[model samples]
Target: MRIERLWIPEKPSVGKDIVQALIRTKRAKVLNAKSAATDGYFSLDTGDVVCPLFGHMLTMLPPAAYLTKEQNAGNYFEFLPLIPQPFKFEPKPDVDAKGKAHPPKRFNLIGELSKRAGQIVNACDIDREGQLIFDEMFLYWGLDPAGNRFLRAKITSKAETDLDRSVTALEKNGAEHWVRQRMAANARQVMDWLLGMNGSMAYQQLTGIKTMSVGRVQSPVLAMVVLRDLAIQTFKPQTYFVPVVTLADGTALRWEKRKDAAGTAGFDAAGRLIDKSLASGMVGAIKAGARGTVAVASTKVERESPPLPFSMGRLQATASKQHGLSVEQVTKAAQNLYEKHKAITYVGTDCEYLPSAMHADAGAVVAQLASVFPGKCAKADPGRKSRAFNDEKVDEHFAIIPTGLVPALSDAEYAERAVYETVVVRYLAQFYPAYEYEKTSLVVMYGPDEFRASARRDLVLGWRELEKPESTETEEAPANGPSRPLPKLEVGQQLAATGVSLETGQTKPPSRYDEASLMEDMISAYKFAKTERDRELLQETQGIGTSRTRGPILQNLLKRGFLLSTKKGKRHEITSTPFGKETIGRLPPWLTDVATTAKWELMLSAIALGEAEMQSVIESQIQYVKTVIERARMQVSPRQSAANEKGAGAAKKAA
Candidate 1:
């Protein structure tokens, strides 16, 4: 006899809703139902009923009676009734000469399932969520975990054709790493639930605020933004002067100004220049000279390595600057390309290359990409740098790349496709060779003034040929010769200068943060922070949020009015708002500090890698949370209570 197999579709949220609906509609009917016992079977007698074996069992058992004695003792185990208890397994007994054992043969669900065990295969999506879904189903069915064979399918698109191919591939080999990743992913979810539920409830009760929520990452990130705003608000600008001189030939030269003849801007208590005034006399003396001899003039070759492939954040920032698309818009397009078109790999990866196993099929990607990236595609080079092949970096999935699927997209989709294609082409270029260039700088001096000019002659365009021209200024110059060659000169050589004039300008504060600069700041927050320890840890962990979460957090900050965009022509300037300042000022010192979050991230990373204990990290985090709750309670209590009272009065009057 063949083993009987049972499969359940797992959709947790939807399943819970359905169960609740069923209970509400059939509670009375189920209570009134009768059970009939036959020779070898038990039957539920209902006029109208449709359910699987497990559902029928659930209907038969009283909710309260289903719980164990310990679970029924308190409300803490409210969820216990929902826990699934699957049918048991039993082996077949040998038939007697009379053709029956003492219990007799029975046709039942459990007996059927036991016989069918060998034929079972768990077919789940190859991801963490899918693994969890299958795991839950297996546990509920009382199936032997070790005896089960698992098969995973990758569904990158909603189209039937794509799904068919995924199913076929899954039938060939199971995704084992995806199963392990699912375990880690589920662990993270449980940790978040525990922290968020308990922490939010506790903090809300302490602070008297309704619906106040906290999470493993969100609260800490919010605190970081508030802290940054505070720093900006308290920032004071200092005065500094730069002196510009006009030569006899009308050329202007700016000299590095100092406070005194000893080139000191300001001196310490040990008799060094400590103020700008000391450089004032030197500026005056230089101004009187009216001319100077060219002291030095030299230039050398410089090369810039190609940038790594686009992570989601990099792609968004690039699109925002180049195409005027918002980060949200670009992210949506990228997600579509990954999920709907199946044209790209995962979007949030920081790595630029696929794993070694993927290298054998690199030619397929290049061949499929031949049309869009004509000159960019080439056979994979075996001698490529180790940075492009390390397995340790290829977590979950490799970097975003072409999926070897020729894209058929609409006009709007084509625009997004171009942006994605640019990233892929650049990534492929890394396996090629470095671009070379000759840079020249001409330093000229007339009277006491000196001026410098620079020009670059590209020896080879290399990967830069793929980049689109943004403006006439960036148009490729004729590669034939140097546009502005300087005459050879000795140290004392004098030269005539043109365009001489005195230019007056006030000292400006640091520029407001733009998207790219903000990204860089977030990437290197510790280095920019006031303390060395803060910088070290931040650098170690790489920044506040992961690639997956940074763009969303920034968007939230902007939407909440903490950060505002100032548009000047095509450029955007991000400045902190007045409300942002107030919020920062009201936040507790520890909560708002970026260092706090940075340290937390460092500790969390260490824990994930088994270098630190999870319990120790949790203990430190709990203490931090307690401190935050106390500070927020003291600071927000009066204001929040007054607001709540006003709301209650309004509600009462309305009623």
Candidate 2:
């Protein structure tokens, strides 16, 4: 029963894979193979056991667990804020059909194993959440998390080579890096718990909204939706006009203002004239046989580098735009490709760069991809290093790439195929040359007015040829102009106007935040920051939530009826419900301001980086929660205030 070393991966399947890899590398042998799945452990010949955690084995204890006896018997508002000194934790429980709660089945097994093992290795995922998982588990099982017996196996993937190397190089559990991660995760969890518990209760007490729930991230996300919906509801369009002259070749050139007349004709910032008379006069004169002389301003070659590989957020946004897939759908498909098919590397990573050492392996992977995508992979020079291969840019995991596993997927797997093919194409795109094009900028003079036109001509379809979707034969042209090459013209060639007309258009309102755009905003939240420091912090933290948690946060809003989503063609148009609007209006500014949340997020990240103390951050949040709750309690409705006074009197009598 005395196991020398215990290995704990994040999932059961991962544990099995790690065990098999150890055996394949002749580093470990099965002592009891049957016990692997039946129980949660696989005893090894090297006197180590491989057992896995089911995501998180422990969760923060609810605030009710720390309520005083008097507070339980009386008005709960009296216990305005419940701050756990050390933050007690309990095993995340499971409920049966009969509604009886019990610890997870493997909880006892892991707990017993922890007690008997000489050394326990935290072989979880290599992320903050993973470290928190092991930290909470050890604390719940009454073991010292910082003890010398505890070690760490920083595993990023389930591949045999990665697992072998990770297991071979076990790190000290109490190392500063690992400890700081634990501290950061702990602070984040504690902050969320405090906010949800205290803020929700305070909101309920003040507004009597029984269905309301507040969170650190979700409230601000809800505020964003509500504000956008209001903006769209209240938006008023202003009409503008422009004189467009049509040439014999059907190229319509819009009138451009000269430097002296830039702001003379009631022109807007975008140079659209609000004066209908001026536009009409220009059109009338141009249509009356006005001859224009061509003034070729510039003609030059322009090269656009290929897009870098996909991060999860980038992949989600692209999939939503190109394939009409939601972020949730793309996430699921990507996860399937990573976990089920083993076709790609880790899917939960935010990093989009690979280690420089991975170039040789990537070349081999590209060679394998040629079998499946011959045309796309034909010119893929994987040996040529792209900007994505910098080692310094890599985070906990590298950008997702094919593991060289050509999966034989069925046609029914639409999402999977979409995700896999996109990833494959994007990865190969970096290996090809930049897309080169000839851009011609022209200015035509008609009497006293000037018109501008531009055209793009393809010079070399380097990566663009390979980047096109399989379903499309031709590339989609840009919106403003045609993709055709412009006709050759001299600087002073005279051209007769075929026709001229005034085009009237109205300004459009901002689009609604669908799941894709919302996710994009969440990643680029620095734009909404109130202060420059918050903006910088948001940029570093990649907006509000991590890629792994953003999808769920959005889904939770839908589940809670805070935001209503409607299917408009292929995309979902998201709008805030009236109740959601009311909830946000009643919530404090700090809870709804993204800049405030971004500051806290940065502090949490700093804790993980060992730049800030965890206890100080947690202490600050505790005081913040207390003040927020007190403010809410004071801002209660008159009726609710009377009811609260009545309840307090009743409680005092009982006490």
- What C-alpha lDDT values do all the predictions have? 0.49, 0.80
Give the local distance difference test score of model 1.
0.49
Off by over 4 Å in 1: 1-216, 219-240, 244-253, 256-280, 287-298, 356-363, 373-392, 440-456, 468-502, 507-529, 533-537, 540-542, 551-583, 607-613, 630-655
lDDT of 2 by residue, 243-334 (tens): 88887777777877645565565777666677888778778777777788997657889887777787788788778766778788999998
Best by lDDT: 2
**Tens-digit per-residue lDDT, 1-655, candidate 1:** 3322222222222222222333444331332224311222111122211112221111122333455454333222123113224312232344689987544233244345444444333333334444455454444556533343444444433233443454345432234454444444444444444445544544444444434555565555554545555566666644444444444533334543222334433533223333556346535555455445776656667765555666665666666666555566667777777655657765655445557766665665667677776666743342554245557665544566667775687785755666676556656765555567777654555432334544567786655665542344354342223554444456677654333333333333345566655664555558546677666657665565556666787777778776676665544556666655554444445545555555665665564444666556655655655554455445545666576456545655555
TM-score of 2: 0.88
Residue 7 Cα positional deviation in candidate 1, in Å, after optimal superposition = 10
Output the TM-score of candidate 1: 0.60
How much is 306 displaced in model 1, in angstroms?
1.1
Given candidate 2, what's the lDDT at residue 360? Answer: 76
Q: Give the range where candidate 2 is weakest over 10 consecutive residues by summed lDDT.
A: 470-479
